[model samples]
Structures are given as C-alpha cells and as structure tokens.
Target: MFVLWDADGNEIRDEYPPVDPLDILRNPENAAFNLDTIIGRLKELGGSDIVALHQLAQNHYIVLDASTKDGRHYIVRIARNSVTSSTSARISNIRSYVRIALDFFRINAPDGIGSISSFKSTANARSGEPILGPYILPSGLHTPSNVFESIEEYFRWLISVKKTSTTVGTTKPDLDEAQVTLKKLENLISESVSGYRYDAELLRGVPSHQDFSGHNVFINGEGLITSVIDWEFHMVKPAVLAADYPAWIRYNGTADPRFVDKTSQFSSYWMAGPLDAKRLRQEYDAVVKKEDPEYHRALKAGTFCRMAEEWLLSDVVDIGCRRMKAWLENSLE
Candidate 1:
C-alpha cells in the first residue's frame, strides 16, 4: 500500500497501483509528460495511490495529487554531488534494489508492509518480479515474513566494495585485518549452519524491500508503526533479515565501530535516528515469539553470528566481528 503524509505529518493510506513504469516512459505522450497523465494511467489500470511523494533518500520523495484515486504519484529520489556517469549507475542501482526488496518483502518479511509492484517490459531490463509473493491485493502485495538474506547480501556487497567512487575509504584503515575478518566470516557462514533453510520460514517468501531503516519507517502518535517507504533500495533476499530488523534498529545503543563509520559516510544519509532500537527489538521479539517461539531462537543462533561476521568483514569493524573474536579468544580462558 502507498502512504501519503502532508506537511503536518498527517498520513493517508490507500491502495497501490500495479502499473508498469516503463510503459509511461515508452509513450511519454500517453503520460503527457505530467502528473495527471500518470495518475490517469494508474487508474486506467487497477491501481490506487498510497502516499503523496515526500523527500527521501539523498534528495527525493514521491509526489501525489488529490485528484487521483489514492492521491499518489511516482517515487522521486535525488542525489548530491552526482555526475552523469554515476547518476545512471545510482538510479540503476536503486531500481535493482527495488526489485530485490519487493521479492524480500513478498517472500520473507511479515505481513502489512509495502506492496510489490510489477515492472514494465518496456522499462529497464533489470526490473522484473522474481515472485508476486504470498498474497497479491488489488492495491498491493504483502510480505509473508519479516527478515530475509537479500539484506545480508546487500551488506556483504557494500562491505566488499570498499569504494564505490574514487573518494570512498580515503582515510587510513587496517586493510589486512578487514580481509582476514571477511574470510573468517565467510567460512563460518558456509560451515556453521546446517543449511540456510531456517530463514525460509522467516522471510517474506517472495522478495522485499531492503532499505527498512529508521527513517523509511514511520510511527503514529500512539507509537504504532504506520508505514515504511522508499522502494529504491528494495531487493530480493532471504526473509530472516526482515524478521530481525526491529532488533537491530532498537538495540543499536552500541553498534560496531565499523558500522558507525560506514553509516556516517554513506547509508545513514537518509536514516532516521529517533527510533527506539531496544523497545522495537522487544516488540519484534514478542510478536515473533507469539507466532513461533522456536523461530525467534533460530534467528539468534547461527544467523546472528553469520550476520556479525558479514558485518565485521563487511566495512571493517562490526559488533559480530568483535564479539566473535572475544568469544573465540576467551574460550580458552
């Protein structure tokens, strides 16, 4: 579903449309190169507007018009200090993230999140729905599970690429340790778990949004989570990561130093900080436990270490990397 918020932070919820973006781009005249054209096109097909576009990512937001069915428009994101070369890649990357995210939410995340829309064949080739997910509503699709692995893969990819541009990682760092840490973590994931099947049940069961950060998430005055926006970073991944997301956000009182550095420079550009990671974790855990107690413990077992290892080796220093080292070193004591 789409979520619309006004200047006063008041929200309006509506069904999401299932139109192909490429179709509009293909025939600009049909879209009339304007907002109303897009809205009319959305309604022509069986779609609804969820939210008016708002500012998000580095400098972008979705736009909405009251004349439309759900009063929603396109998701507009802007970037800073971007070049023509990088802009294409960045936009392309965001689109890729969206596909993976849709899969993630559909296959792994819990219900009541965002809907996964289909891409137009005329649109970019990368835009394809791997799965429609467990349920497809007239307005949108639902995430069957909460956590998933596309997130892990995304983090792994980010950590592996120390620098996306020439400007990344100019500061002094122990490169040797980073490499070694990554190796260890990879080994652990490959050998430690019986199989990655444990995440099968926890993931959204199709695909989902990977950018489930604090800022993308919204809560009403009563403190209930109302919405999560920004589909640019969405992707297809394992569902377990979505399930454990609330915990990671809530108990972030003491995050790994490496994660701090990474976010400070890159990811946190659009992150919302006021989220209560601890309380959110508690709530997430309670909900999962109520659903299935064993499922909760499974998230803690190998998955936690694997995630930590991935993070440790990821950008350099992670809570998991540090904690794993301590545990191993202290085991002899």
Candidate 2:
C-alpha cells in the first residue's frame, strides 16, 4: 500500500494518508515522500539503468537494482515515509561518525570485519555541496546522529528520550513491566558508571554494528562476507557495549533452532579463514578484561542499558520492550 513500481521500473510512492510535514520535521522517523524524487537524486549520484524493483519488506522499503552504462550494478533502496525525515546537520554528523567507526574497524580487523560498501550521499558525491530536498542516502540507509560527546552524554539522552516517549497500553502488562525494569536498570547504570569515561587501552572505542544479523549481511560462494549492509544503527561504543557476539548467536530461547543453525553456518563461513565465533568472543573478552578487571559487571550493565535505549527509540515498542525485559532478566546475571 505504500509504494508501487511501473513497467518502466520507475517508483511511485503513495502518501495518500497525507502525513504532516511538521511531524516529519519534528521527528524524521515520521518521514514519507515521493520515491521518484529520490530516484532522480540517485541518478544525480551516479545510478542509472533501472532494471527491477524488488520489495524487501512490504510497506517498508523496496530495492531497485540498476546498472551504470559501464555495467556496474547498484542497489537503490527506497524507504516508506515512516523511516527518516531529518535533513539536517545531525544526520550528517551521524554519517561521519559511522564512517569513522567502520573505517577504524576495517583498519584494526581487516580479516574479521566483513566487506561493506561506503555510502555515497548526494552531498558527499557532489563534493560536500548542499543539495535540495530531503537528504538522500545511498541504498536508503537512515543515519541520524543526536551528537553525544561521551557515554555519559549518551546516557542522559537515553533517559530523556525514554521518559518522554514511553506510553502505557491498556492490554500490555508485559510492556508496563518492561518499562519499570528498564528504569531500574538505567538507574543502576547511572549510579555505577556515571562520569566514568570508558578509556580501556584494549577496548575504549571499538566499532559496533549494533544491528549485525544475517538479514543485514550478504555472503558469497566461498563463505566469506561479500557485503555488510544496513549501517543505520552503527556506532563507536565501549568494548563492553560493542564487543558482544551478533544477536543471532545469543539465542533468546524463542528463536527457531533450524534458522539459528543456518545463520550460524553463514556466520562461520563469513569469518572462517580469519576467525571463528569462539576465538572472536575470546579475543573480545580478553581485551575487555585487560581494559578492566571488572569488565563482566560493565558488560552486564552496558548490555542492559543499550537494550533499554533500543526499546525506547524503536517504533515497535511491544517487541522492543519485550526484548528489553527478556535481556534484562536473562543476560544481567
């Protein structure tokens, strides 16, 4: 119901419900607009020869596969209006931050970090010149940065957002419980680590693809990671916060074992030559402990804090809140 593609493979995005521009301006998460304009901008940014439109998620986004005249395939992702609306410096700062983090990971863990394409925003492609219309990112990745100078700054922002954004539902007792649990955890973290700047020699500012899962990555014939996509939630966080295994391996007990096994295989293949999951976890743990003997305590606290933040910021509060509650109880031990 959100987007359609024509015989010419051009996009037609419907905003028939007519979302308020002010709402989009206030929170880019409410953004929705014409996909054709985005396509035009992509063309300006060196994409052409539109071939097919493959829907990635119904009513969410679509991927447009195109080739340059020189035969270079490009994946053009178009999101529904409910994704991002921020076209300001905040988004730019976030993009720069993620780029720096990814670059750092590439330098430090060239074998472990998977291959991924760098984003080419319209502005960046035009040599940092200003562009009209909403900020158009390559592959439609939504990157928004609220600018936190330190982990303490991030925590304050998280608390403020959670307090302002949480809503009570009549039928969702579990959600209510999650909110309460999250508040308690947040308080604990604030008391334990407030003003404690993370400065571990082995683990201070490591890159984390916060949403690193099978869905966001692509693998090749040889079982190596051909591409890692979806840098929307990328950040440079503390080793305790960033160094955990991918969520797929965490096995919340509700995940299908068959699917988990498949994903595990893919992950193993992706890092087979350079590393394995056991070695990766061991290396991360060793570094974390070297940085702080009480690293396990920090890891438990940081993991809970991050999950609570994700719950607060996510649009799907029911699922997010459930995850917060589950992880708070299960992983905090």
Candidate 3:
C-alpha cells in the first residue's frame, strides 16, 4: 500500500495494494466515493463542512467544503503523483521539467514568452532554505507577486542561469537527447523571438509547477478545483508551456497500453487539445530546423538520424536496467 503523511506524523491518506488509479478499481472500497468519510476527516483536519467530491476536467478532482459560520464551500483537490522506482527517475524528472518548460513556452507564450509566477523561492528547512517556487492552489491562497512581477523577476534570474557549459548550437552529449535537441534548436530562440531560446533568459518566464499532469490535478463534483497541492516537484517555466505538460507522461512509459489503461480509468477527460497540439509541434519543428539547418536539411532528404538517435538512448537505458533488475531477482531466487 502507498501512504501519504502530513508533517505532523499523522497519515493523511492511504491506498491499499498501492497502484496507479488505472491499475486497480474493481475493489469496491477503492472505487467507492467515500465522500462522507473523506469529508468527515477533512473537517477534523480544520476544514469547514464537506459538500461533495467531484471530478473536474482532465484527471483533476475537486472537494467542496463549507465553512460552518458562512456556509461557503471551499474547494480542495486531490491529485496523483506518478513516479515508480526506476533507474532514470531523476532524468525522467528533469526531462519532465524540460517538457513542461517547452510546453509552457508554446501555450502561454504563443506570441512570444510567458512566465509562471514566482514565490519567495525558499522554505524554512534546516538543511538550508528549501526552494519554494510559486503556484496557485485550489485552497485560494495568494502569492505576494502578481504574474507581471513574477515574470520580470524570472527574466532577471534567467540572465544568470544561461546554460554556459555549451553554446546553443553545440551538442551537449553529457545531457539527455532532449537537452541536446534543445541545444541544437537555439538559433530559433531570440530575445524578441516568439519561441523558446537556448539561453538562460529563454527559460525565465515559466509559471510555477510545470508538471500539471492530469494525475496531479483533481476537480470536485461542482467543477471547482479544490487543491493544486503537489509543489515539491514544481518547475519555473512560462505559464503557457504547461498547457500540454500532461503529454510528458507518454515519454515516461505512459505510452504503454497498461499505463494508458490505468490513466483512462481515472481520467476520461484526458485528451489532447487540438490548438495546442498544432502549435506545440509547429514550435518544435521551427526550433529544430532553425538551430540545425544542416540537420534539418538532411532530414528533408530522409537522411537525418541524430534526432532518432537522441530519442532511443532512454529506451536502451530502461531496457538495460529492467534486465539487470530481473537478473538480480532471479539470482537471489
């Protein structure tokens, strides 16, 4: 079973036979919409009164709770975070951030660039300050900075974060294929251009929480978002870049039929938005071609192979790790 805990050491929630939502639902208890129980628990947790738990667009869900004094139902969301143990989980996480950054660049910055809001960027962790980025939760909490303010600060910060180890056009083999692809696509990025740039400034305007997968977002019965809670893995990218952030799951083994089946079970609203699909692809192509005109030209003649080479490495890694794990298990047996 998978369990979630609050800072107080109390169990916040638990799932038996822990699996993704799409994995097991036949068990009535798991399928049961024990709203009453959940609501009761929330009230005990300083929540008002419980109204309803409804599904929202995408895989997100909402919880409606009313304050006893005013009887106004407050919204709360419950989202799932999908990260099973795997060798490249860290790489996958980083790639997910990149995917979100690109996605946000496409949507929110259609005309140019869009940045997510920023917060104090630090927390009270004894290990030092925890990086607390900005995000809007269903709880209706507000950040001190507005979007404009956040975006400006992000631009200023980007000036210092330019990935200097390699130039935009140069290949970065130490990085993943996606990063390499991004590096090759730098010419398309410009200070005044309307797409992702290869410099540090290009990434400045990201809105907080780039990984807005349907699994992490929850909507309630009334269609109100209750909580957009998981900020631990948030990224700072353009707000629009996250428009198609959910698609990143496809790269992380989500394309497997098993994974798809599991996701569909929980989120019927999961589907690509047409406009976004078109724009994202267009933006991707524009960058790839602009950054490596020679490679793009070769691709036109059907000789381009680096792009495919870049994509295949991850699968090779995944297979190698899986085989190693299986072999180890068999040896132990």
RMSD of each: 16.9, 16.4, 17.3
lDDT for model 3, on a 0 to 1 scale? 0.33
lDDT of each: 0.38, 0.42, 0.33
> Over the stretch 1-333, how does candidate 1's per-residue lDDT look in tens digits?
243332222333323333222333333343212445444444553366533322222212333323334554454222121111232333333333333333333343223223344543536676554333322222222223332234344344434543221222233354444355556655555444435555545533334444455445554333334456776545443445443443124223224332344333223333213343344445545655565564455445535543543343233333323433443334225
Model 2 scores what on Cα lDDT? 0.42
- By lDDT, the better pick of 2 and 3 is 2
Off by more than 4 A, model 3:
1-206, 239-333
**Clashing residue pairs found in predicted model 2:** 28-85, 31-81, 32-81
TM-score of candidate 2 relative to the true fold? 0.42
Q: Which of the predicted structures, 1 or 3, would earn the higher TM-score when compared with the native?
A: 1
User: Lowest summed lDDT over 10 consecutive residues: which window, candidate 3?
Assistant: 303-312
Candidate 1, poorest ten consecutive residues by summed lDDT: 76-85
In candidate 3 the C-alpha lDDT for residue 254 amounts to 29
| Residue-level lDDT tens digits of model 2 in 61-102 | 334443455555445444322212233322332233334333
Q: Order the candidate numbers by lDDT, best to worst.
A: 2, 1, 3
Per-residue lDDT value at 319 in model 2? 30
Ranking by TM-score: 2, 1, 3
Residue 251 of model 1, lDDT score: 27
Misplaced by over 4 Å in model 1 are: 1-174, 195-206, 247-249, 252-259, 262-280, 292-298, 309-333
**Between candidates 2 and 3, which one is better according to TM-score?**
2
lDDT per residue for candidate 3 within 257-330, as digits (tens), equals 32222213322223333443344444544554665443233223321121121122112222112322232233
